[model samples]
Target: MTRLFNEPSQFADELVKGFVAANSQWVRPVAGGVVRRAPTVEGQTAVVVGGGSGHYPAFGGIVGPGLAHGAAMGNLFASPSAQQVHSVAVAAENRGGVLLTFGNYAGDVLNFATAEARLNSEGIVTRTVVVTDDISSAPVGQEHKRRGIAGDLTVFKAAAAAAEAGYSLDEVVRVATEANDRTRSIGVAFSGCTLPGQTEPLFTVPAGRMAVGMGIHGEPGIAETDVPTANELAELLVSSLLAELPPSIATAQDARAAVILNGLGSVKYEELFVVYGRVAELLEAAGITVVEPEVGELVTSFDMAGVSLTLFWLNDELEGFWRAGADTPAYKKGRVGSPSSASTAASTADTQSFAEADRLTLAAETAASLPTELPDSSDASRDAALAIADAIEAIAEVIDEHADELGRIDAVAGDGDHGIGMQRGSRAAATAARSAALNGAGALSALSLAGDAWADRAGGTSGALWGLALQSVGAALGNTTEVTGSAVATGVSDAVSGIQSFGKAVVGDKTMVDAMVPFTERLSREVNAGGDLVTSWRAAAEVATAAAAGTADLLPRMGRARPHAEKSLGTPDAGAHSFALIVVRVGEVLASRHSEFA
Candidate 1:
């Protein structure tokens, strides 16, 4: 049922509509979605910032009186096409020359470098500055490979201030580069985002799990683990960024740094501040000083539920500029502070809800119980399931290689992770499942082993639910040498019943039951209707697919995401999609092996 959009060949056109609407006073679309507006100044050095969209306010919001004059906006999470970059330079250049800056990513490097050349030919001078703050992107030896995160804010502010202070374009670029070199950042994702008008998310984070070092878009993270609490999450992110901070910065007497607590769209501000408070406390304890802490949605991914913390090791020059007066619709510090005084007085009479406190406690407890060690890989069924896990692992590698194109497909429905999570979980499961599979064990036995490994190795509410489902199915078919449609139906029924009992959820819960319940129900109808196993399975698969589709109409009612159930009505549950895929694939496998069964 998923289909691709063909109307807009390029994303820039759609985004420019929004950009011009938002900044008509200060910005105008010049060429190729590039905004030509600059902050008020004359004969002053200029700083230019740009990158793919979806990380909003980065290149665009940073353009103002105390910021860059013009910004070159790229497509969503993709580098601007070379022609687009070239056109932007034409609009941004002046007598003071232009200084270009963006995060350090391969596509960006290639595009910007090309733009630099084209600009020179036009007789406009331009220089480049790259930010490398994500320590996890590269090992210590390959620091250049790391991509910029929140730290880009500091570099932009400093660069802009320098340009406004009458420094030459060369000096501005140098100062900006220095700020980037001294800044670092790290992030974790709880959920993914979707492109505008896309029904499905680009990536997925399994329930009760988090993706550490997640890319600005839905790119893969360093690892997926049990979801951590605000405090714990802050601790981990801060520790990672600090580990990579220049030791001199940490030990210096003036080891002051500014923190930009960035929200990846849809994350509530209250939660962000909670995390920020902890980050501030931790840094203070570690002999680091926190300068003016900026907390808000500065950069975003359509509707992703994640956060990234950026720290800029500041010197007097940077600090002075950071505090210097500047105003933009999104990045203003002065107007924002003034409103709080009046709003706080009006809201004080209202009672604060303690609901977040309860949720926070539960999340912390859940994180603590996650499985870190893999279960024994000695069982045959476990091994086969692990093979499926291996299939999932292969998928992640595929995604990493094709990251540039993933958003196009994933933006349609369900988070694109049908490829990523399966790859990660299956890979982990296979490593544990293979020990038993290699012994040439029977199908049912391998599956049972896989169930155990999956439950133990995967660390989300989904993993636990799935592991339980598989274990129930394995138990129903104990000692069976092979699986037939009847056997599969029975296993599926038992698995569904087992999961339902513990989770106390129903078919319309927008969970896996959306697919499983319908498939099992149809399987029973087919067998009673007197069809052979294969025909019965095919019928059941059809039913499962329909039921999964039906979930798009039902809201999630049982889980951490329950509050978002209504919003999810038009999107199928991720678990349901996974189940449907498994059912369809299993049916195909059985059909192909029909002769063996006979």
Candidate 2:
């Protein structure tokens, strides 16, 4: 469980601030995340790596001369938005092209691919090599389906080293892709991690048992069994990886590989060393040689009692790149160069008086931006906008009631941050909607502002999708119009279209689309039949509730749940359930204000 935090929603922002203050010598604050304080060589391709926070020394902690030029940090267990990645790419561009590399997750894929396209349109050459190295996530001959874990380090290092050696963007991407193709990783956890301010763990391992193949974001394991002896555990890990050798390795014998024994948060150094001892013997017995193996905590989930093993098969070129020097804030190898100017005694001469103020100013400047200008509105529109605020209040209240339960559902096969993400997004949306309504904004402007706040504050797939839904609705009901049942129904239908297009999920994907599609269709039919807003919403909410409940019998075909599809059976899709829950509450709110759209 998490204990120390001022505000749960602000945890990611606060930690980044503290990290920059302490590691100013290696990194400086950027709009989205962090970048190296030290300058880089001219015309060197920039390597930008990032994902969600909580996994330290992965995204931000590896920003340095011989590593990534910048990192785009996201909320805890959530991928950074496309805008966040773009910000970091812009900051790191140095006349050469940009290479974005990170773990392969659904949100990260959507966000980073969007950023890559955006950068290309602006005449900046950008490419990506998504790391998919976790052997347990997918079966043989389906390596592309695997997710990245501790192996993120290997791919990021390969790209950075290539860039440091002045490789072109195309060559850097090639090297990183090859590194990812060769890397294999597997992880196991003794217990689950708890999110900040949460009362319980996302999912728990039974006492005297261990979970195999759990994800860093608290995704439940694919298999669980009684705890094994240290030697037995090492044998399991080693044998599992050995069964699926990389295509680059013709045989295991006499092959050299870069090895990493990663401790996920609470696992200590001595324990890792003990595990590595047996791992080394197993490799030696098979005639496989290990080179420059790292045994420590590199990538981590906050306080997760787990360990992961990564093997990066080394060819001649890869071995050279793997041994390259890097000097980040957390992870370090051989000396990259002289200490950065930020670390000089001269720079620290006045550390007492201005440090705290500087930190505060940096945090303010780095905060995510929100929309400010409100659209034109009339008196009637302003009155109608009040309903939007009331509806958001109801949504927030319902989420507050069932957040823990939503987390549990998500933990069945997902990262288990759905509840926390929704809590932050809804609270921010409610505040924004209320302020907009009070300030004379119309339904269009009020809802749009709230959408911006939700997406910016929450920073996840759910946040982005929900924000898009609000914006789509608000766009349909432009300011200064007479609000009607037909208009509201049309808005929801438009939202369904936009969400499907943006998220690339279809009706039977076992996502929110399953329930949202039904709700929108029913609402459109009811409105077409001359039903009032309250009546139509109530009818739609009922349909949504049943559809959401029906998702329990289906297997997920999209997002994080796809890898652990079987584990998610008998549990409703958290996104669908939350969406249905919100609409049901909104229907109740509309019933009280039934005369507004009459």
Candidate 3:
């Protein structure tokens, strides 16, 4: 377990601070993450890469002369907020356009896509390359649905190299896409990792057994079996990747690949070498020539005792870029020439000034702007805002009370962060709603602000989904005189639709949608029958609770849990349960405040 940490919530921030201090020669701190201390060529495309924290050397550690220009670091196992990504991108941007690259997880996709849109809106050209190289997350036909794992390094390196070599933004994107398509990775874990302050690991493997196709986020593997010998493990990894060679590679005998035997966290370099030795022998036996193979921790999950192998199929152009010189704090290759003196001086000054200015701007923008006194809105609007605040406060308390239970449920088949994420999001949302209410914002505005805070603080798949749901509902609520039963029902319907659209999860996917759809349907029906807000919401909450309980009998069909669907059969989805709890608690608050409407 992670013994070293001041506070669980402050871990990511402190890690970044210490990292920048220790690697001053290579990286400098920005508002959201780290940027290269050494300036890039002016008008050259900048490659920005990032993801959740705990995956060191992957993101921040790779920011330097020949790798990522900047990295938008997030909380542990969570994607950075869109604001964080945008700030880092702005600090990293030069005359050339920017190319954003990261793992293909839901939160990362949502936030990165949001950042890309925002950048383009601001007239800063931007492109994105989502790395999806893990073969275990999806089938061959649904490759787009696969999650990114250790192969993030290969794709990021290729993009960064192309950018460093003065490729256009489009060309850099092309190369990164090709790298992702040609690369394949598979991982195995002896044990799961623990988050800071958490006494237990996310998941556990039985003694004398190992998990195959395990994700880096402490998610249980798809299959578990007796631990194999070093040679056998290596063979399993190689065979799995070789079985799915990219179309560009004509045959195994004729393939040339750049291989990476990556340690997740606690696995030592000696063990990696032992595995790589066997891996190299097998590849040679298959007549594949391995290029400069890397064996060490590149992407990690806290202190997970696991390893993943990545094979990047190579052609002439890819091999050239793969061998290109790189000088980062944690990774370095062949020597790279020094930048021009004039450009270096100018770039240094520009970087310092831009970083400082952006930091101040971000600080100002993020600061709370609560009013000392309520604004002069309608009395009905004020009452509605207060009611919303009360509901959110109730929701927060309920989530906090059951957070541990929810985490336990999630750990059965997923990374066990759902409870913590929901707690964080709900607390942030409650605080934001209270502040907005104090400032005399209408119900719609308050909820919208709350949604933003939830997404910003939570920083995960659930966080993003909740944020979208709340924002969609708030938009449907509007800022009119008073919130009516019809409006509330319409808002709930809109939220359900938004979540389905955003996550692509249907009602039976064993996600929050399972509960949410039932709740929305019931609420709409009750409201259409001329019921009051409290009555309709209470009825909907009951339906949601039953629907959530019913999820115990269904198989998971989405997210990380999909791979371990059978394991999750007897457990309720953490998200669905939490949603049910929140709605029920909020309904109680609504009932208590029914007098306000009267």
The predictions' CA RMSDs to the true structure, in order, are: 21.1, 3.0, 3.6
lDDT of the candidates, in the order given: 0.64, 0.86, 0.85
Task: Tell me the tens digit of each residue's lDDT in model 2 across 65-120.
Answer: 78889999988899887777888888788989999998888888887888899899
Q: Per model, how many backbone clashes are there?
A: 15, 0, 0
Q: What TM-score would every model get versus the actual structure?
A: 0.55, 0.90, 0.90
Ranking by lDDT: 2, 3, 1
TM-score of candidate 3 against the unseen true structure: 0.90
Model 3 ranges off by over 4 Å? 30-32, 218-225, 253-255, 337-362, 365-377, 595-598
Collision pairs in model 3: none
TM-score of 1: 0.55
Task: Write one digit per residue (lDDT tens) for candidate 3, span 311-389.
Answer: 9999999999899988888888887754223324456666566457546755664663334444345777767888888
Give the best candidate by TM-score.
2
Stronger candidate by lDDT (1 vs 3)? 3
Angstrom error at residue 139, model 1: 1.9
